[model samples]
Target chain A: MGVIGVVATMKVQAGKEAEFEKVFKDLQSKVKANEPGCLQYDLCKSKSNPQTFVIMEQYESQEALDAHGKSDYFKAAFPALGAVLDGAPGLEFLDRID
Target chain B: MGVIGVVATMKVQAGKEAEFEKVFKDLQSKVKANEPGCLQYDLCKSKSNPQTFVIMEQYESQEALDAHGKSDYFKAAFPALGAVLDGAPGLEFLDRID
Candidate 1:
């Protein structure tokens, strides 16, 4: 009913941070341009670990987040993202309290 | 120089979600009212597990974030919060890229 927030942690392979960032920038742009329900989409680099990225996203609702996952852009981008990640990303989904 | 984002995972002991949330709301108010550099302070509940709360915060800069940690409010609030949490909260600090 309220905002759906997502926190996803990605660990890039040692030498692949730069490459991963390049690919991610495009994905972020597409998320912003294509997904109207997506309220905020931000990618951030960890202060302590340069190879780790934490994506912070907010959607209008749970259904909106579900739709974002089903988008063609996401279908393509997810695989591209997986290839650079060290392991499966840690994802936590939440509903905003305030 | 840029936005400082924080993702903190808190697993509250069962039956404490309500209390934790109550205390947290007060803390959130304190952060917003007292800290000019704190751009955002949001607390969220996990959809699958209500016991887990994720705090998403943004600050104007690294220095602003540092000041937040040293504030009297934080020093007092952190201990009050820790009493309800299951274990040490997982914290990740990031610099927004987009």
Candidate 2:
């Protein structure tokens, strides 16, 4: 109910790295521009496994997260994410404790 | 190696969460106090699973990580972390891309 944190891992297919990042950059920019309730949404590339990417996101509330999911930008971009990813993403939902 | 980001997950042994967080708090404070190269160190608890904890840490470079691992505080606290955790922590090393 408080601020929600998300740490999700998506592994791009072997040869689709460029395309994955390109789509992600657009999603990142749109999220930043359109979602005020999205406090921070950082995109990271794994150092251990270069094909893997991690998204660290913060939302003001659960409602905000729902809103984000229902947004036009999210709808437009999510399919593109799934297309380039190797398999299902690994997601962990978190809350600030300290 | 430019800037290293780490997302580590630890699930405390049943009935030992209180102890785990206490040790973690101490470690967090010490890292902030002593590690100049650590730009950010955030502690988060799982919303989906309360016993799980996530630590998001940032270091200036690989060398800084080596220094962190070698610090007296790290040496002292890491064993405590292992003792309270249900299993070995899950660590994912990352680099900022956006």
Q: What TM-scores do the predictions have?
A: 0.94, 0.91
Best by DockQ: 1
List model 1 lDDT by residue over B14-88, tens digit each. 998898998999989998999999988999999889899999999998888989999888888888899999999
Error (Å) of candidate 1 at residue B25 is 0.4
Query: Taking the tens digit of each residue's C-alpha lDDT, what string does model 2 give over A1-98?
Result: 57788898899999999999999999889999989999878888987888999988878888888898898988999999899999999988888765
Query: Per-residue lDDT for A1-98 in model 1, tens only?
Result: 78999998899999999889999999889888988999888999999999999999899987889989998988898888889999999888899997
Full-model lDDT for every candidate: 0.91, 0.87
lDDT of 2 by residue, B1-98 (tens): 37788898999998998999899999899999988999778888997888899987878988888898899999999898899899889998888774
Task: List candidate 1 segments past 4 Å from native.
Answer: none
Worst lDDT window (10 residues) for model 1 chain A?
Answer: A71-80
Q: DockQ (Cα-based) per candidate?
A: 0.83, 0.77
lDDT of 2 at A60: 89
